[model samples]
Each structure stands twice: as structure tokens, then as C-alpha cells.
Target: MSRQGRPQDTRKVSGELFSLTYGALVAQLVRDYEKDEEVNQQLDKMGYNIGVRLIEDFFARSQQGRCHDFAQAADVLTKVGFKMFLGVVPTVANWSAKGDEFSLILDQNPLVDFVELPETHQGLLYSNIICGVIRGALEMVQLEVKVWFVQDQLRGSDSTEIRVKFLKKLEDAVPAGED
Candidate 1:
């Protein structure tokens, strides 16, 4: 009989694996074709695709599932999702009155350890993947958004902040002659 109290082999590979496995895939793609810039673009596209798929799963696993409003969506993201996936719950640093801009203030980041930006790409921390994921998920529900890391505690600060700007609500395309 199986161990009475033991959990099953149910733990599966997670989003972290995508980040790790992508390197080898990109390397192989470059090795086969010998194109650097194209490979770089592919890597970025792969990262974006990762954002797209993972956000779907994220929403599915959330307590409220999909949110009907952006405020609740932000709360779920800042609280439960981050804690479960990244082990840190960011505070809502600011919420704009315009209802289109907000900030997630992360005091701790587990993913940034040993991460240093190359001189050519010094302005990035790679955590922007999370931003892209957030944007992609909300955009799917008709929220047009822009997300970026406005501050990095890793760069020597007491805290880090990610700013999410909602640009516009995506309007449904009109039929021919209606536009």
C-alpha cells in the first residue's frame, strides 16, 4: 500500500522551468541557424509567450478565479499570486485616481539573486517578464495596460516598485462599414 500520509508524486514542473529551459532552446536555435539578432528576438518572444500561458494558469488557480474589476485583480495579484509563486507579497504603493495606473511595491525579490545586468542591457532586471505577464493577463479581459519596473531595490534602495499604467480599454473592432 502507498504510504498513508505521504502526498502523491503530484508536484509538476512550474514556470521557473520555462525560464531555465528557454536558454537551451535558444542556444540550439542559434546553433542551427547562426543568427544572433534573430535569436535574441526569439528569446524575447518566448518570454512574452511564457507570460501569456502562465497568466492563464494563474487566473485559474486564484481564489476568485478571474476578476470582474481591475481593483480586485490588483489585490489578488499583489497578495495571493505573488506569495504563492514568488514568495513575496508586494504592497500597493499607489493607486491612481484615474483608475488606469497603479504600482506594486515589492520589498523583497527572490528571483533577482545572482542576477546582474550586462552592460549592454544595464537598464533591465529580467523581472520585467512578470510585468509582461501581468499586462498580458489583464489585457485578455479587455484592459489595455503598460507595466514596467519603476524602481529596483537591488540597485540599492529600501524597496522596489513596479508601476502598471492602464493606457485604455480595448474597444471591440467594429464590423465593416461600422468603423
Candidate 2:
């Protein structure tokens, strides 16, 4: 993907401020929810909402068209989407033989910059929001996918890895009363 016409000054929030804000949100969720799994679900749900909107901004700013294949979609996501949003581009690897699954390896995750999972919250996937974001964005573009974190830096992993599996393309929905 080309970055030729992409806006350079689109980032309104500083990296630290964004990270701190996210950290605070996660902490509050942890306090509000009794189980770590619930907190994770909430975070993913929040991210899904964000992604649903975020993709519109992505389209406007990126000026990109439809991806021809899953490989191209994965490449565009890691190269364009991640860089545009998180200021980082993860390496795409671990492709399944059928070309329906892949992993995104992040050497540095901004969300975890100031986060440390406590022993009591070991079940929490600190960066699960990312998975939701991916799933949501892809869904908006007609791709049904399963996204999850297979490895996390906070969970003693050397790197953060998110696995994405393509399920099926969604059929277009007709407008209400238009059929």
C-alpha cells in the first residue's frame, strides 16, 4: 500500500496520553467487573464499537479501495491500518497452509506501555482490544473473521502476537422495506 496521500498530522492524541487514557480505562474496568474475563469482554466490546467507527476514518484518510484477497488485506492492515492508528507496523507471519489464517507479531504494543498485569488478573488479555478492533474492521469490509491473542508480552511472552482467521464474507443486507 502506498502512503503517498496519507495525512501526516492526523494524530491528535500524543502517544503517552493515549496510552495513559487506555490504561485508566482498563483499570476502571478491572475494578467494575468481578471476573477478568468479563473485563476482557467489555474491552473487546468497546474496541468493536471503536473499530466500527474507526474504519470510516481509515477509509477517508487512507483513500484505499477494496482488498483483492485475504493476503492483501492482511498486508494492508499491518502496513497501513496499524501504522495509521498505533504508529507501529507489526510483522505478519505464521500463515496457515490454506491461507485463511495469519498472525501479527508486535514488538512494541502502545497499549501495554504503562501496563503490568497483576497476579490476580492473569486471565485478562491486556491487548484483546486489538483483536476486537481487527475483527470489527474486517467485518465492516464484508469479511467475517475470528481474531484473538495467542501470545501477549504481559503474559511473559517475548512478543505480542495476534492471530486472525478468516471465516466467510458476509452477504450484503438489504435496506429495511426496500426488498
Candidate 3:
């Protein structure tokens, strides 16, 4: 209900808020960009920016420590992160032999509720922002990763599957002028 779902919060935003806000933002992006590819890129960029901030708040509120490995990261993502933010925990599957890649099957996507992609946006992945969010969030915790939507229910697919590939851990660099 509440965007952050704080424990003491009794008030809640309408369920349609997520869908309507996303739809309106996408529509505006399409109008302003005038190209599906550009719109998708912009959406991803926007999502990345949001993710960068969201992770901080998530960490502060969830009080979760650093993930030791990709497996632990995946568990935290699907079990804790998704449940807290989206109110639904996606199923994680299709793990790679090396355990560096896996797919999250989203049985329900609040961002796509009561929405339909028009013919003009045929190639658009409406829920691509979620991929960007995952990548951005992981990057903040020093985990460099690549995330994309493999299947989208908005495009008439049976389910939404987001594929995440763990690339490498990024090192923290000190600023030249900093202590």
C-alpha cells in the first residue's frame, strides 16, 4: 500500500497508482522521444536513477547486510527486495551452471496492470524499467550486473521473465581530493 511499506503506516496508495503513473510516464516518454528505442533507453535511464536512490532507502529500512555472493544476492532480491517493494515475490529459476546468471519469473507485475501496448509500441518492452532497477541496485552494492526482460506479459507473453547476469564486483575508488 504505502510505497515504502513502513511498519507504522496505515495509509496506502491506491493500487492503480503504480499502473497509472508508469503508463503516464511511458506515454510522455514516447511523445517526447518520438521513437520506441529512445523511449526505452530513457525509461531505463530513469529507472537506474531511481534505483540508485531506492537502494539506499532499502538498505536503511531493511537493515540488510552486504550479500556474500550471487546466490545470496538472488535470494535477497526475490525474497526480500521484491516482496517489500512490489508486494509479490517473483520466482527465481534457470540458474546457470556457474551460478552467475538466473531468471526471475514475475507472475504478477503491478506496473503492467490494466495496460495494453499499442501497435506503435510493438517492439517496446514496457516493463524494461524493472531490469534497469535490478542492475542499478546491484551496482550500488558493488555487484556489477546485467539485467533484461526476456519475456513480457504485456507483449502477450505467458509470463514476465527478467534475466540477470552477474558480471563482476566493482571496487570502491577513493576520490583524489578525499581523505
lDDT of 1 by residue, 27-103 (tens): 46556645444554544455456655666577677645656767887888778777766767988868899776789
lDDT of 1 at 48: 54
Tens-digit lDDT string for candidate 2 (40-97): 8988887777777788899999999889999999999999999989989999999999
Error of 1 at 32 (Å): 15
List the candidate 1 regions with Cα displacement exceeding 4 Å: 1-47, 63-66, 117-121, 171-179
> Which stretches of model 2 miss by more than 4 angstroms?
1-10, 173-179
Residue pairs clashing, model 3: none
Model 3 residue-pair collision total: 0
RMSD of each: 6.6, 5.9, 4.7
* Candidate 3 RMSD to the real structure: 4.7
User: Among these predicted structures, which one has the highest TM-score?
Assistant: 2
- As for TM-score, the candidate ahead, 1 or 3, is 3
Error of 3 at 54 (Å): 0.7
What lDDT does each candidate get? 0.63, 0.87, 0.84
